[model samples]
Target: MASRRKTAIRLPRKYAKDEVIEVKTRIIHPNHNGRMAYKDQGYIAEYYVWKIEIFYGDESIITVSASAALSQNPYFTFMLRATHSAPLRVVWVDTQGDQYTESVDVVV
Candidate 1:
């Protein structure tokens, strides 16, 4: 089983219909690129969040593709239009086929 990591998100609890709001997210990850080598250990295997998707209810809001170039514990901020009161889901998929999901309720 993949190790569980921490995630943080910030958004308004409520908003007017069609209101544009800022959504911020951060994930705690090592994001190894399989290129680094230590004096004792061999090359680290590549393990990074390769894709991220956000959804409002069943509708997809955004999708992002990331690479190893991204910094450790990547942070992202984006704008989303509030259309209804529903659960917002965020999903991240890593290179190792590990997935992490989280959700928060938003009132529109």
Candidate 2:
């Protein structure tokens, strides 16, 4: 299925190693849980973004799991330590087996 999604994020342009930095993100998705759908279709089949994994450069940062209760466009805010100057990668997975990724460059 096509991932109709949009993501917004904020990160520090520079930081020190091990320094905590705030990160904010929001993703746009139909998040159609497929549990409720057109009467003729007998529900959409519960398709929604369920998991998200974050990576700082090659290092795995954090992972998150979500459910259909999430709003259509999910919002997330967290703190991550900058171990080095690298690009932060955020990948999200949906029930439809769709993946969405966003990246931010940071200098540590």
How far out, in Å, is residue 18 in model 2? 3.6
Q: What tens-digit string does per-residue lDDT give for candidate 1 at 1-108?
A: 256548867897667889999998888888997789956779888999998899999998799998798888888889988878899888988998988887888786
TM-score of each: 0.87, 0.81
Clashes of 2: 5
Q: Which window of 10 residues has the lowest lDDT sum in candidate 2?
A: 1-10
Give candidate 1's error at residue 5 in angstroms.
6.6
Candidate 1 Cα misplacement greater than 4 A, ranges: 1-5
> Model 2, range 1-108, lDDT digits (tens) per residue?
346448767986666778999998878887887677587858777878899888889988788898788888887889987777788888989997988899888776
With candidate 1 superimposed using the best TM-score fit, by how many Å does residue 57's alpha carbon deviate from the native? 0.8
Q: What CA RMSD would you report for each candidate?
A: 3.1, 3.3
For lDDT, the strongest prediction is: 1
Error of 2 at 107 (Å): 0.9
